[model samples]
Target: MHDPRVLLDPATDAVRKLARRGYDLDLDALEKLFSRRTATVSATDDARAESNRAAKEVGAAAKRGEDVTAARERARELKARIGELEEQQRALAAELDEFLIGIPNLPSDELPDGSTDDDARLVDTWGEPPAFDFEPADHVDLGERMGILDLARGTKLSGPRFAVLRGAGARLERGLAQYLLETHTERHGYTEFSVPAIVNRPTMTGTGQLPKFEADLFRTGVADRELFLIPTAEVPITNLHAGETLRAEDLPFAYTGHTQCFRSEAGSYGKDTRGLIRQHQFAKVELVRFCLPEQAAEELEVLRGHAETVLRELELAYRVVTLAAGDTGFSARYTYDLEVWLPGQGRYREISSVSDFGTFQARRAGIRTKAKDGTKGFANTLNGSGLPIGRTLVAILEQHQRADGSVRVPEALVPYVRFERINPDGTTS
Candidate 1:
């Protein structure tokens, strides 16, 4: 949530930045709420203190054998007034919390002062799309022809946006996740973790996925009030330090984990509905980090490099794009989306998105570190999908497909799958 001080600090220049991100902060409304709250608290406190003094006076009068009836009446009146004011104060405090919780995070200074997709910049491509003699088929057609994916039965078994990866298709998805986790942990510096797929609402909201994207999530029907299936490992992994303080030496924490992410696809109708591109459930390997504010820029570059390495080693063509302020995720100040070249689709599609959230999430989660002077504030956060296992599987099948209907697996994945090619007949070539 945005800091109220953003509106008060003139030197911070948050108004123009907030305007760029589509936020019209109502400083006046907040001031009114706070004013009422303060008045209510003061009235209640004054009444209680007056009542105590009056009671003491009445007791001393009785001790002196004097009349105490007038003092007793005054104390009774103060007690009644304090009770009424207490209720008003509680209500006003609740309203303030509601307003604060729903507000969006402040954008970083480096974020372009704009609110549109056109503001985005094309960074560059890592590799070029491969040339094909024949018109390449999309993932749905390619997987179906190879007998590795069954879309019709998958929908029948569950519903639309769900898939059944048979034979080599299943192996490919597993191999993709393994490759990503290994790259992040072995080659890069990240702690590998296995976390719960279902978590509480606080965990979801902490990662900036709840209170807005709730419709896109699949909540557990049996216990919807207590748990929601995590949309990404980013939810649980990034929130590990919630409600805690870390030492300065423990700065720049990085972690990697793989899990099946569930989405309801609430608003996306008839978009990438045919194949693994858009699924109700898909597997992904996630990377998350907590770092100092000054370290966020460098951390973003390092994490981006880790995600790009997966495609590079697999020899898949890909490019990176910097998301505009308006196009970036809710918790992120900046983002870099890795788009892999799909020969079949004839265009690059996003396979991974690396983001630097700055201190947006950390503030919400209360994850912080004490400064040398003993003051504390939110920690900066960063996360990315090393790569989506389901989508990467689709890209590999379509990109490495041979004219004879055999799929040449990436050389890096041969050892994991125990073969280099998956023939059309569901046999190793």
Candidate 2:
């Protein structure tokens, strides 16, 4: 959420910074709202002062043995006025809050100025897309032939865009998630957490997923409370410290979680409906970080490197791209998308996104940290998919498929899978 003062003061640098985000600022509307809010506040203050003065007058009149009826009547009138003003004040405050929460975070000045994914700038590439001896098969063809992925049955049970992993496919998915969690916890210094998949409205709102993107969420009614299936582990893991204050020593808190993410995919109708590329339910290993304000920029790079390490360890080819200002997520000031090379599709697809939210989420979440000098401020928050298991599995099957229909397990996941390769006959070799 932006500081309300920035929207009110057009001449401030913060306002200018917001202008660079390529959105038309309705300064006149904002000013009108600001004026109404200020007027109510001023009226409330005046009423409060008048009520106080009237009470004193009643007391003085009684002490002087004068008739206090008129003073008491005036006091009652002032009290009623104050009550009405207070009600107006509350309504105006709610209106301002709604306006503030709807505004997206200002894009970082370093971000590219375009408005679409095509405008994103490529920052780095690792490894090369594997050369195939024969025409590579997409994950759907490979999984169906191996009796692993059952899209037909998935559609029977649920509907389109749902999938079921059988036998080796299921194990492979689990193994990949285990590898990612272990790598993040044991090597990357992130504390692993198993959080609840169902969260409340405030929890979702804390991460900027509610109110704005409600259509993309799976919401349910649990007794009297409304709950939502987490779209990402970032939602719960990041909100672990919501409405709390941490010490300066805990400036940089890192956490990792593996969870089943459920998305409604409301806006996407006919895109990537085949295979695991776009699914209603998917598994993801999420990484979240909270740090001091000045450390956010550097922390984002470190977080991105951690995600990149996963692809490097698996020997998967991928590229890092800086998302353009308009393409960035609502809560992110800047984002880096890691697109893995898929031989089956003959192109790259996004497997992970690392973002630095720069206190935008912390402010919404009421998460704060106390400084060494006793001053308190909102902490900067960041999160990334260390890797999503479904896409990683898609990459593995396509990249490691042999001419004989066997899939070679990456060296990093061999121990977890207890085998080096999965044969078409459902046997491990």
Candidate 3:
């Protein structure tokens, strides 16, 4: 959420910035809402003041031994008027809040202009795509042949877009999650957390996942309490400090968590349906940070590098791209998508997205920072998929597979999975 005053101020370029993201800011509508709220507030205050004055007049009239009937009647009328105005004030404030919450964050001015993924600006490319001596099999073929992935059974149990990893595939998924968590916590200086897979409404909204993207989420209920399956660990981990203020000395908080994420895949009916590329449930390790607003840009770079470290360690070929305004996430001012090369798909697929929300989430979540002088302001929030287990596993299988159908595990993962290769017979050796 944004400060309505700043967004409504004519002198600010909030509207123009929002336009870059394809969000048409209805300033007139917003301004009118703000005006109505302000007027209601002012009227409420005036009525309360009159009520107080009338009460005082009644007291004085009683002390002077006067009838005091008129004074009491005046007080009663004022009190009723104050109640009416206060109700209007509450309604208008809620109306204005809903309006502000619906607005997307303004895109960074330095972003490359575009409206789609094709217009994304390529920032860097890593190792070259591996050359194959034979036709490469996609993860679906490789996993099915090895009896590791069972999508047919997954659909039987749940529905389409669900997956069941067995044997080596399941082990690899666990190993990747451990590797990611250990790397981020031990080497990247992040505090590891075990967050809940189910969260409440405010927790989801704190990270900009509710109200706007509810259709893309899975919902549940416990008795009368409504709950949501977290789309990403970012939601629960980043909101760990929601509605709290931290000391300036602790200006930056890096949190890493592994969770089984769930998403409804609402609008994506037919895309990436063949494999784990798009799934209803997947394992992911998420990285979240909270820092002073001025530190956001630099922190974003550091966060992006941290995500890249996973690909580097896994020896996967990948590229970093600055997403166009139109392609950026709802709460992010700037984003860098790390796309890993997949030989099977013959293209790079987005494996992770590191985003800098620049206090957009902080304001909404009520995450604040307090300086030494006792000044307080919103803290900037940022997060990235340190690595998604499913996609990373897919890349590993496709990139390291031999013509004989055996898959070589990345050297780094050998220690965790206890083997260097997944044999064609579904045995690790």
Q: Please, what are the lDDT tens digits per residue for candidate 3 over residues 268-387?
A: 998999989999999999999989988988999999999998899898999999999888889999999999999989999999999999989989999988999999899999999989
Q: Per-residue error at 400 for model 1, in Å?
A: 1.7
List where candidate 2 sits over 4 angstroms from the true fold. Answer: 11-22
lDDT of 1 by residue, 298-321 (tens): 999989988888889898998888
Best by lDDT: 3
Query: Please, what are the lDDT tens digits per residue for candidate 2 over residues 66-169?
Result: 99998899899888988888898899988878888878887888898787879999999999899988888999999999988999999999999899999899
- For each candidate in turn, the TM-score is 0.90, 0.96, 0.98
Q: What is the number of backbone collisions in each predicted candidate, taken in the order shown?
A: 0, 0, 0
- The candidates, ranked best first by lDDT, are 3, 2, 1
How high a TM-score does candidate 2 get? 0.96
- For candidate 3, report its TM-score: 0.98
Model 1, 218: alpha-carbon shift in Å? 1.6
